[model samples]
Target: MDRKGWVMRAVEALRLATFKEIQRYLDEEGEPFSKKELLDTLKALVAEGLLEEKEGVYRPARKKGSAEAFRRLFGD
Candidate 1:
């Protein structure tokens, strides 16, 4: 997977993470990424609405359709 993909995977796995936490997760996953590159990717993800950030912490964005999908798969 690409850097952005790896970053997204890290955030999804972590549920919520700070920059340093993401960096460490990537390192442990054997994917060494520069701070600038990671930051840029994260900003792009936030802009694209694929991830959300607050107070320097990042998490996967909860899309409007996700709740509908969940209800379909389970129940109201």
Candidate 2:
């Protein structure tokens, strides 16, 4: 039940979330993630190639196709 931070949010966002939605979810949690934290997580995922940056937006990598996709999308 202790869900917060990069690892956890990655999965939720894997379904391809909008920035507002992500920010909103974090806000609903009481202490929302700092902009730095959010940026770092996305940047890290982009580096790993598990995320695709398009038109200034970030989304899950395309065609995951397998369980490994889920793993890459999230889970440390």
Candidate 3:
């Protein structure tokens, strides 16, 4: 998939997004979006390697390293 798709997937998987949850996030954000845009974005993210599937569940792949440093330094 393209880079935009990859980025979206990374965000989704990192966030462990379900389809409906992702849709709801977009919806409740109070911005306007067409359903097609949301779904297509998700499908593209799935095409990228940012998400992993386990037992029918999808979550963002864990980045290797320490969040401890990040947390101490930047407070996320």
Q: Pick the candidate with the highest TM-score.
A: 1
Per-residue lDDT over 1-76 for candidate 2, one digit per residue giving the tens place of the 0 to 100 score: 3333443464455466655566676677664677777767767777877677766566666765778768877975
lDDT of each residue in 1-76, candidate 3, tens digit only: 6534543544564476565665565556554346686656555655765565555355776664587658857897
lDDT of 1 at 45: 98
Clashes of 1: 0
For candidate 1, write residues 25-59 as lDDT tens digits.
99999998999999999999999889999999999
Candidates sorted by TM-score, best first: 1, 2, 3
CA lDDT of each prediction against the hidden true structure: 0.95, 0.63, 0.57
What is the model-wide C-alpha lDDT for candidate 1?
0.95
Model 1: weakest 10-residue lDDT segment is: 63-72
Point out where model 2 deviates above 4 Å: 1-14, 29-31, 63-76
Off by over 4 Å in 1: 66-76
Q: How close is candidate 1 to the true structure, as a TM-score?
A: 0.84
